[model samples]
Target chain A: MNDRTTVSPSARTTIRRLPELANHDRAMLYSIVDEAYVCHIAFAANQDTHCIPTAHWRKDDYLYIHGSNGSRLIKALSAGAQASVAVTLLDGLVLAKSAFSHSMNYRSTVVYGQFEVVQDSAEKLAALDVFMDKIAAGRNHEARPGNSKEINATSVLRISLAEAAVKVSDSLPSDKDEDLDLAVWTGILPLKTTRGMPIHAESGEHIAVPDYVKNWAD
Target chain B: MNDRTTVSPSARTTIRRLPELANHDRAMLYSIVDEAYVCHIAFAANQDTHCIPTAHWRKDDYLYIHGSNGSRLIKALSAGAQASVAVTLLDGLVLAKSAFSHSMNYRSTVVYGQFEVVQDSAEKLAALDVFMDKIAAGRNHEARPGNSKEINATSVLRISLAEAAVKVSDSLPSDKDEDLDLAVWTGILPLKTTRGMPIHAESGEHIAVPDYVKNWAD
Candidate 1:
């Protein structure tokens, strides 16, 4: 099922000339999403499209995203439906003489499908657990479970793996022969995003950070 | 033009509250876009949608984004068609006890509308100037004008400001009263993306860095 046709069977996708990477590169796709602690979610709403930048986690072939009940995204897809989600990481910058040739090094993935709220009490509980573990494994069991009100007020969405693909670009741009001597500085500005020290809340609070929190990345 | 309407606007779309960032707070939108140099461009194609991460620069109300003439995006939105473009900057990470509460701080702008390639030679030249100025202020004048082939091969899209908004979140997760004693870290992990030194390429030749390059960022 994880074939090029299964994901983007359209002529619109142009991954043919790009070597070292393919549209169906599962490892690359997973790595980009896994390395990122957040994803940008976009969808069409009111004939106008809306893009929401949100934190998300992936488990197996599905994505588990949630937010407070008041969030528009929660309400949009929670009412028995689905939408689209995308995650990406900028690897580096591509500088060239021609402004039009400037590009970026990055790995990105897009998943399109329907998403619905986790309904069955057990499944919903499991989904919630998966999300918790996905973020910080053992921490799921260490922290206080959401009170009934908190559970009821928040919404969790489960979007099964739909059509998706990974696109990666890591090339330093190529400049024309004559234009190459323009004397302009034109090289990459490498970029990396990583999680920093986990600061404790200011308020008087006390709890041990589970080992899972220490190992969690991506 | 930007107002809230609660209705299933289209079959593929349902209104969602994505931070309500566009509600009269328009200047915040421009500032966020200006600070970000890269954006993830997404669109609905085939049976599923796709998101392509690329570099982008803005001028006034319009954003000029381009790629290889063979790019999937260039093919999809050629000559006066609409598309969705988004730029985001991840500022920090939000750590909370509950895995579900884990989040990030970011500023992102999502814009939707039509785009048309600068088909006219004069228009393409103007866009090329804008492109250079956006990256290196006054370098476009010093560089040679793009010929027909160079101009013809690349696709330059002009996105209107009709539908767009900036959604931001910088809050530390709400540390609960009881969970306060849990002792787990619950604060932010700051992030910063900066421009690095530029790399210039010549015919196995090294040319002195021009004032244009030296003062590029100055």
Candidate 2:
């Protein structure tokens, strides 16, 4: 399933301007989305558009994003609006030989699709599990599951990754031959997302941080 | 000019859901934009909408984003379409007491405005400087500036931060009293963006790494 053929890009998903940087591999797109902790979802709020940053998790071909049931964007999505989701993982800073060529090395996926509100209680409950387990393995069992009351108050929208585009620039800075002779330093300063020592909450003082939290470095 | 009064949120920019976490402080918004290395910009492409991850920098009242002249999103913005720019700084993970409350600590800024294409050569050059200097101080001068040809090949869009909103969730996970007694560990796992050692490019073998690069911990 993780093949370029599975991710057939339409006119919207096609990377036309800089086609060289576009990757058609489905696995690459999945990896970028999976590794990212947040996604910026753009949905039409009346005539105007609003892009919101929210936590997201992926299950198979669908990307699940949850928010308060009262959110304007969530309401719009739940009402069946085409949403554009962008997840970008910044890998490093590319110091090019020239200022114009300077850029960032990032793996970004843009998925354009209509969101389907997961209404079934069973599916919604399972979707909540995907959120926790995706972030940290075994977190679903460790934490108390969401009760029906709490689950009903939250809204989950699922966007299929079937129509998505992945753009990545993971290489070293490419410099012009003329600029190579310049005395300026050219290279990449890799950026990494790291987890610091977990801080126990006021109510969590007695419980020990599980192995999942300790080894949770995404 | 960096006052909440300047960043007056309009109806479209207001946060109706979870309004308590919304911040109107302009400085907080500026700091979030300044600290972020990349931003996701959404623009319309005929019947389709595209959200792209691109490098962005902020000046006093304007947020500047540049892209290839041939890019569809850049062209759309230049053609006076309303652009939605979202900059998100993920700070940590909030492991709530229950799955329903699982959230992320992030400072996100969403700006809604019609981008004005920067036409002046002098202003475009200065904007490029802001891109590098904002990310790494003093590196703009060290590298060669964009020549007229390069400048002409790039399309720069400036969006005012006037109609903008900043949403932040920085608090620890809040769980219900009933769930607190569960054996699960609940707390915050802080996420930090750190820079690793600078890697020299093929042409930068002999040049000493500059102080600006060494001290460049964003």
Candidate 3:
């Protein structure tokens, strides 16, 4: 159902400043969510707003998040609190000729909606499997699945990706005509999220390293 | 000063779940903020809550952020809207024997406060220099400084780090005794933000590369 490509679904979602950086493609929104392992969710409760980071994954047109049943985030979100979720990937630092022109290259997406509690047990289990698969492909089949009690104590919630905005700034540094002629080094110092060598747990030393672990750093 | 080591200075900042993972060290809180380039801010405006990502820099015990004077974030925060800011660094994924035990190793901090606008022109310029130093040391002196008109069009704001909560999860993956005996490879796939090669802007190719850009990826 991601064929819908229009963005800025509402007044608040519209990008008022630097509107050129706004991306209208649905795939752009999906890619931003898929690439990020964590997202910050903003919601209000008890006259205070909170921005909390948590693991997230996406399936179809819904972005899913799970938390302990007793968590304040879960308690407020499940009670129909409006939520704003943001995922950002910093790509590089753009060094412009002028201090005011210096900027960062990043890809970010924001979703605005009310999170719906995923009440169906079967759907919840499927969503959890999707999350596990994201962490490590084929991991759901290898690991022991969550028990009934464990499932009951966790709350799964999803927000529709229909109302979202994506912004991407990946271009090279730009400077004013006068500043460009100045003797200054200008370019992009790229930044990337890369995987490092795996660290095996002591208890799993006897087990063979899976393909996911082997290819992690590659 | 940062000598105050107490964390969770307010009731809402308390970590109720997995309280053992809560950190009380002020140094830990400062490190978390210092290491991150961006943070998500939660604020209410026009009856809608927003989670926005922006660049941040820490000076003394305050976290500073800047934007154009016309931006909504600058307008809302400068007017004394309450804010909840969160910075998170994901270290790795903890793959355990059981799906339910899977977790992530991360250091996260949340600060609750109202931002105070930087009114003094000299103070604002000094803060911007501090931000430049974080991006690339010695580059502030090399680049063309912001002129009076440019400085007048920007707004800088800072929030105190006094009321904050720090949560750190950096440990080997653990599983239930019964699940630990299963033939599964469990460990951490570490994630790191690394710098890549610098790409020179076409207009600045004649300029010599500075020491910062030369050693960026090193």
Which CAPRI tier for candidate 2? medium
Candidate with best DockQ: 3
Model 2, residue B196: distance off in Å is 1.1
What tens-digit string does per-residue lDDT give for candidate 1 at B1-218? Answer: 44332111222222255434333345666677677767766665454455566667666667777776886667776743346787788877666766545666777767776776767778767876776666656767555566778778777777855466556776777665666666565666566664445554443445445565554331
lDDT of 2 by residue, A94-161 (tens): 88878987878888889988999999989988887887787778887777777777888888889989
Superposition error at B199 for model 1 (Å): 6.1
Interface quality of candidate 2 as DockQ:
0.71
Instruction: For each candidate, report its DockQ versus the true two-chain complex.
Output: 0.32, 0.71, 0.87
Which CAPRI tier for candidate 1?
acceptable
Model 1 earns a TM-score of 0.77
Clashing residue pairs found in predicted model 3: none
Candidate 2 residue runs with Cα over 4 Å from true position = A1-6, A203-206, B1-6, B203-206
User: How high a TM-score does candidate 3 get?
Assistant: 0.97
| Winner of 2 and 3 under TM-score | 3
Per-residue lDDT for B34-127 in model 2, tens only? Answer: 9888888877768776677888889988899898898887888889887889999988988887777777888888998899999998888888
